[model samples]
Target: MSDKRVPSMTPPNKAYPREELEEMMQKWLAANVEAEKAGDWPTYLGPMYTEDAVYSWNIGPNEDFVAEGRSEICDIALGFQMHGFEEWEYPYHDIIIDEKRGTVIGFWKQLAPYRRKDGSRFEIAGIGGSWFEYAGNYQWHWQRDFFDFGNAKDCFFQLAGAGALEPVVKKKIHQQAKGALLPGHRKLREEPSRWEKARNAMAMVKIAMTGR
Candidate 1:
């Protein structure tokens, strides 16, 4: 098999300089966030992945949507932008750096136009893994499977799951879920499949156990 870097969790004992690793990581997250803010997804992915990059979405639930390569991935990403989907980005939060395997994983939040509907937004959280190779410094050979966030409700549960307040601070979500006539908010995930609903529901249940 042709040797290529893959995302892994193998810890490093003594590896490359810390400064060098941080630079590549900053480049990875910065470019991603820049594209997200500017809606320039094509430019966002072009630098970090190869043409034949293997990627996917919703590794846990809602696994139907999938893509490969820069073009295919950007097509899905830009589709959301063209449709006015918005997100909350945290480029520097909870980042774990491993120089041995040359990978970085961090937490992210995205709130955007729903896939099945327009003008309505939902939220999700994901972890990005970037595997790199040395070109005098680290250059990403490929970044794949940039996914694993749950649905809008799931994101809320994620925050709550992380020791945040459990009370549904915003009444807008349940309003939207029930398809109520609310201004500035619309029903997006009104009727999700059994699995889709289960993931977020169970996640929220865990939040209640956290003593809110």
Candidate 2:
């Protein structure tokens, strides 16, 4: 496709139309969503984001979790494109448009295989809430905090997808075992001790299975 600028730069359309803006934002979302689901982010990162883009996994590993610029951002996700994704998630994205500032509020989630080749799946999940700031040229300028997954499978997906989770995620299952008995909040029960142990074991297995 042409890298040519749009007509709005001049005056044929005057200002950026709301519909056009939403569509453009949708395309960015589409790019991210597709890349995330298909497990290839290079396409989205290249054609869909700006050079100075920011990536924040909310406080990161240390105070060093935040990355500025496209290169830095890629450093965070490149490994995932290599060793992760396929063995992992159900990446979900919910977008909200802010026409005034030209931004999108993206709610994302990573979930365990709801179905697998061996016929195994989780009955619970969690969702994350994050936001993306646009650079006005159909690219992202910044990405900020979103909530943690509320269920086991979701966080597990995040841990696997990130490829850097030193502490594996089996908390969701434990939490479910302990909490959530109501209708709207009904979830699988996961006790503290059980989950911690199972998760630790899982962590060891994951580490041994994949040297990633």
Top candidate, metric TM-score: 2
lDDT of 2 by residue, 1-212 (tens): 12221112111222444686687766866676676677667656565557876555432111223455677566553333233344454344566766666656766555444454466553234456656665666666666645542454354564455553333223433444584221112112333488788998999999999984
User: What's the lDDT for residue 32 in model 1?
Assistant: 73
Off by over 4 Å in 2: 1-16, 59-64, 78-82, 87-93, 114-120, 149-212
RMSD for each of the candidates: 12.1, 15.7
Q: Could you tell me which residue pairs clash in candidate 2? A: 126-150, 129-146, 173-190, 174-190, 176-188, 176-189, 176-190, 177-189, 177-190
lDDT of 1 at 109: 48
Which ten residues in a row are the worst by lDDT in model 2?
4-13
Looking at model 2, how many pairs of residues clash?
A: 9
Q: After TM-score superposition, what is the CA distance of residue 148 in candidate 1 from its true location, in Å? A: 7.1
